[model samples]
Target: MRGLHIVGGNQLTGTVTAHGAKNAVLPILAATVLCKHSTIVNCPDLSDVAVSCHILQHLGYRVQRQQSTLTIAREEEGCRDVPPEWMRAMRSSILFLGGMLARCGRITLCPPGGCALGGRPIDLHLSALRQMGAVITEEGDTLRCTAPGGLHGAAVQLPYPSVGATENLLIAAAGTPAETKIIGAAAEPEIIDLIAYLQSCGAFIEYQPGGNLLVQGRRELPGCLHRVLPDRIEAATYLAAAAITGGKITVHANPAHLAAPLAVLRRMGCSITAEENAISLAAPERLQGAGSVVTLPYPGFPTDLQAIFMALATAAEGYTTFTETVFPRRWAHVEELRRMGADITVAGSHAVVRGAPLSGAALTCTDLRAGAAVALAALAAEGESTVTAISHIERGYADFVPTLRTLGAEITLTEV
Candidate 1:
């Protein structure tokens, strides 16, 4: 296990260029298999994206990674399809099953792995593929999918706008032979990024005036190069960390893209100044507690930032409520934070946090964003802190300890 050794009571102050969206890059990488020609992608160094590339390679795609760039082309022997062993390693591995099944007419995948925040079932993905005329079977831990003669697009209405389900459907629909329309589509920036990549590859897709998407499938996709958008969630985490520790940091990314989280920061009395592509935040010596925050989908307070904001709430002078609507059981980190001297109580999906001075303790990361929250709280705490099982953090955050250390934080990493 790898743990981050953080000496607390230091302010993070520096300029940090945000990386590509871990969420956006994964599904986009899965979409590369739809192309007969090589596809080039410029992305940041994120472990999850790299792991997705490895899964693709195991499926027999010729993949090359140089720094932040990835070039992927079909192998001479074609792909043998992604196996169940590699699929169980990461949640995004499920994404390739749809694309590969649509194009290759067969695919098999195991249940994917990631942080245990809540029950993230792939039933929506399976149902959508079934509606598109695919034969799907479940045998114990493996999912076997076959879409003979390729897939035909069908109208899919997601019970909930799951980002993974939406991307799976979109990628599968892009390679199919019929027109596919998705109702109540997730309008997140990540979804838009995937749509842009599909459009670049000759898929005719349009976002209707209402909340629906229309995709016209094509026979083959052209070789294309694309650059990923900067990670908004990472930007929010850093911004909240700066506010929690009473420091100033300029994030060089699209600031307007962070309106929701930035609004929450401003409400918490953090002084925020913004430019076109960069935003600088300076926390007040004393933070004023914003009473309540409810996490929602796109254009709302993101669930991804709920953990970070909970940490920020700890530095406030009063009480704050963090509510999770997307994942009912996502407050697993509340108990971990309480162990570190934070006054917090978890009630189902909501957490009631009372502002208190936090002291160091040995903490374990319950999930990916939760680990980031742990770091945020530790930076504002009174003494040294050790965060264990940080593989979840490493999956989404690239060079995390170094990034924090560059901002005047005292942190080191040890493998134990």
Candidate 2:
């Protein structure tokens, strides 16, 4: 069992560069089966990444990892069906459904699992694949999909913009020699990064108006090298940590990707300076609470940052309200924050937080982002806090503790 121990009241100040986006890396890796070889750079060293590599090896790909770079080459006969354990390891494992289906006309896997966020159904993904001519059968907890005649390009009309569905369809359509139009697709920066990687590997993709994604699989895609985009969530987390501790820090990342978060910080009385490739934030002595914030699809405030912002609200002067639309049950951090002597109330998908003098207490990590939220609270608290279940936090952020230490956080990890 591993846990994080944090001594409170240390203001983090310094510069940090965000690692590659995990959301980008996973789908790109899933899409790699469409190519014969691939070389990816700037990938964060995370536990999920190691699992992805294990999956690649299971698919008969020779994988070589060197720090932040991964080189993959096919060495043996690729396997179409991944084990149930692998699929159950992370929700992202469901992404293999599309890639494997495209690579080998069939695939067998169990329901994917991760941090139980609540009601993350893959109905859109399955329905869209059905629209594209995939015959899927659900047997118990397993899903068996077969595309005997192979998939074709069709208009995938989604009820809402779901990122996983969009990425899965793009990976499937990239291998089907026809045009696939994804209507009402998610427009997250991670989606754009996937399109960039696919384009670099010889797939024809267009980001059209009305949030539609068009993919033309006119030719076979070969492997190509691509450096993933900076992780906006990681960068935003750094900013939130700085704000809660009333510190100043510069984060090297794309400013455009962080527009929504930066705007919220600016509204909270923080001094914000945005450059072409980097953004800096200087928090006030006593931070003022940001007003209401609602999470919507991209170009809006991201749902991923909601927990971190909620943590930030506890350290602010007034009230801050957060409404989570993506995963409404993502209130795992609220109880932990309350244990640390913060004031918070949750009803349905909304949480209202008030600034209170916080004292550290023993806590637990519930999910990835929620784990980060509690850790941020530990930094701003008045004493010491021990947070267990750190494996959740490692699934996404790269060099999380090291990065915090670099920024002068009084934190350490005890691995047992």
Candidate 3:
């Protein structure tokens, strides 16, 4: 395994540009199967991206990558069953269900796997598909689905704004025979980006004012080129890293997509300067703790950044409470942070953090975002620290260690 050895007490400075959004690119890559030819530019080189490309290749797509650009062409007949091993490596692999089913009348694949962020059931996606005239059967770890009569348009409403579920339905509905309306759809910027890409491919998609999405199915979609939006989660992570170390950093990203997190940091006494495509944050010598934060759907605080914010709150002046309503058992990093002298108490999905100076200690990352949280804590601690399971961080962040190094962080990767 590989680990990060970090020397604390360094103020991060300089500027960095955000990479393409992982959440956006994964589904967009899957949607490429809907067209005869497609090109995705500004794609991040992430493990999850590689896995998605491999899945596409297995399905007989002519996939080619040059640097950050990916060109996919459907040249041969795609496979109907995805290998069990490939599906088990990535949760996003489940997204292929909608596009594959739309193209081929049937698909068989095992349950997808990813980070252990609690119970993330795919029941919503399955139910929505069944509502759209799909027959699904579960056999042990595999799921076999068939739409013998082909799929048709239907009205589907989500109990919650699940991003993955919304993307799956949107891709499926785009290839349907008629108009499909989705209620309570996830209105995240990534979802909007996917819709824009689908529209470029001749699919008619509209976002109404009240969290409704309308997808007008077309007889065929043509190949198109698209550039992904900048990753807001990555931008937020770097911003929080700068704040925890009491540094100044300018991030090149879309400021409009990061309104909620940036507002929270500004309330925590960070001097924030906003521009059209860039944001600069100058952290105070000591940060002040903000009030409680509740992770909600789009336009609200994201659950993805909750862990990193918790790490920042550990060193603030007062107590900060974080309530995660999106995912259960997201506090897997609380114990690890406590090992480094952080005062944290977890009760179910809620955690109360008491600001206290932290000292460096050995830590193990439990998941992707939790890895980032520990790295932030180590950067702000008083001594040297070692963090293992860095592979999780690499799954999302592109050039993570190198980017932090550019910001003046004394961090290095070592294999053990």
Candidate 4:
């Protein structure tokens, strides 16, 4: 286990560049399994990506990482069953099912694992696959899927806009025998990026209004290099850290594809400036409270960023309520923040945070983004704060400590 120790009340200053989207990069890597030749991806080196690479390697794919570039090449026959124990470490392991079924017509894997935030059901994933003409059944903890004579795409509608389910359908439909029309699709930037990469692999796809997407399946796909876009969640996390610490910091390589989080921060009295390729944030000397924000799909307040935003709202002038409609249990960090002297209360899917002075205290991270929230809160606290069990944080953020240190934050990490 590893822990981060932070000396609070230090105004973070300097410039930090946002890395590639962890959300986008993971699915893009999973899509590589559909390629016949080696695929090269240039992006940040995050632990989740490393775990995705490990999953690919377990499927007999050879992966080489040089700095930010990852070269993935398949060297063996199709793997029917994905390693079960390996699946426990990463939730994105479920992403392999779609590609494996598309390429080899069958895939067996244990249940995926990630943050225990809520009940993340794969029902949408199985339903969409079945709609695409794949037969699926559960064998204990393992899910076995087979599509003999390849899948034939059809019109499928999701009850909710699930990012993981949408991505799984995209990968499965990319190689099926029939064209797949996905209604009520998840239009998150990561989903769009995955569709774009699928198009690069010779899959035809188009976006319609109201988050509907149509993917055309074909017989063959050719591999190509893909450069993942900057991580909007990571960028928002950094901006929130800046706001919470009353610091002035600039995040380079932030994509304008996301505007909701930036807009919310601007409303919170943070000075936000944007150019063609860069987004900068200068924290106000005194942070003002934002009334309310509801987490929604893309182009709206992102559920992924709600935790970090709560940390920024802690020092506000009044109370702010964050309603997370996407996932009820997403507020795992609320209790952790309360441990650091924050005034917060969670009611069902909503959390009310009253602005207060945060004092340094020991806190434990519950999930990936929750870890980031506590880290941001620690930056603004009055004394020393120790964040224990930071292994979850490393799964997403790339070089978080170094990035914060470069921004003049008094933060250090010790391996246990």
Backbone clashes under 3 angstroms, per model: 0, 0, 0, 0
Q: Candidate 2 on 4-31: residue-level lDDT in tens?
A: 9999999999999989999999999988
Looking at model 4, the pairs that clash are none
Q: Candidate 3: which stretches are off by over 4 Å? A: none
lDDT winner between candidates 2 and 4:
2
Write candidate 3's Cα lDDT for 279-327 as tens digits.
Answer: 9999998998978988989889999999999999998999899999999
Shift in Å, residue 190, candidate 1: 0.7
lDDT of 3 at 21: 97
> In candidate 3, what residue range of length 10 has the lowest lDDT sum?
73-82
lDDT of 1 by residue, 1-416 (tens): 88988877888899988888888889899998888655545586876877887877876777887878888877754547676666766789889977887778897767788777797888888998888888988899777789877788798988888888889999999988789999888888989999998899889999997689999987678657878888999988888878888899999888867888888888889999999889999998888778889988888888988888998888788888988898888987787788778898887888888889888888989889999999889888989889998988988888788889889888899886
TM-score, candidate 2, is 0.98
Q: lDDT per residue, candidate 4, 4-80, as tens digits?
A: 98999889877777788899988888888887654555577877788888888888888988888888877886564
RMSD, every candidate, angstroms: 1.3, 1.0, 0.9, 1.3
**Candidate 1 vs candidate 3: which has greater lDDT?**
3
Checking candidate 3 for backbone clashes, the offending pairs are none
Tell me how candidate 1 scores on lDDT. 0.85
- On a 0 to 1 TM-score scale, where does candidate 3 land against the true structure? 0.99
Q: Top lDDT: which candidate number?
A: 3
